[model samples]
Target: MTTFDDRENAFENKFARDEEFQFKVTARRNKLVGLWAAEKMGLTPEEADAYAKSVVQADFEEAGDEDVIRKLLGDITSAGVETDDAAIRAALDAKLVEARRQFIEEA
Candidate 1:
């Protein structure tokens, strides 16, 4: 193969690896969020597991961390649970800010 073709292949592989790594990290974060949401909502273990999986699945649709966090908060409220929205909001907002900072640093 030409040198240009080899370079293109290498770039493609790097891009794919980067995407896969990001996906795994995002999934792990979503799982933790799910567990937290369930605890906040006073859900049982089975319910918490299911809820976490659902949260991660929803996030798989390209929703960013902040968006997922907001939605999870809303979901807890919609379930008629007495959760501290202000606390959750603050936590999510702080996390969002950190994520942005990390992205900037990486860039």
Candidate 2:
């Protein structure tokens, strides 16, 4: 193969790897955030696990984090838990950091 072709292939591979890494990180963050919210809502252990999975699936509803945030916020309020958007957003940020750290450690 030509040098240019080889370089193009390498770039494509790198892009794929990066996309996969991002997907993992986002899913991890969603799970962490879901657990946190579940605890705040006082869900049972089994319920929390299912809730976390649902939170991870929420991301698929849209192209960005808004869908997950909306789901958590709505659920929290509907469950009569006392929380605001600021707190949820803060949790999301913290969980993202934790998720990235965990993923790096695992790698």
Candidate 3:
């Protein structure tokens, strides 16, 4: 292949890898947030895991984090747990940091 073709291929590969990494990070963050919410709602260990998976799946409902955030907020309130949007957003941020750290370590 020509140098130009090689460069294009490399860029495409990098983009793909970056997208995959982001997906993993988001999924991990969702799971972490789900676990935190679960604990707040007094869920058992098994229930927490299931809830986390559901949170992960909830992300597929939309293109951004809003869907996941909405799901968590609704679930938390529905469970009669006391929490605000700001707290949930803070948790989401914290979990994203943790998820990125874990992902980097795994790499």
State which candidate has the highest lDDT: 2
Worst 10 residues of 2 by lDDT: 80-89
* Candidate 3: tens digits of C-alpha lDDT, residues 1-107: 69999999999999999999999999999999999999999999999999999999999999988998899999999999988889999999999999999988987
Compute each candidate's TM-score over C-alphas: 0.66, 0.96, 0.96
- What's the lDDT for all of these models? 0.73, 0.97, 0.95
Give the Cα-based TM-score of candidate 1 against the true structure: 0.66
Off by over 4 Å in 1: 61-67, 79-107
Predicted structure 3: lDDT: 0.95
Candidates arranged by lDDT, highest first: 2, 3, 1
lDDT of 1 by residue, 50-103 (tens): 998998788756655556756787888887876665766665555445544565
lDDT tens digits, residue span 1-107, model 2: 69999999999999999999999999999999999999999999999999999999999999988999899999999999988889999999999999999999997
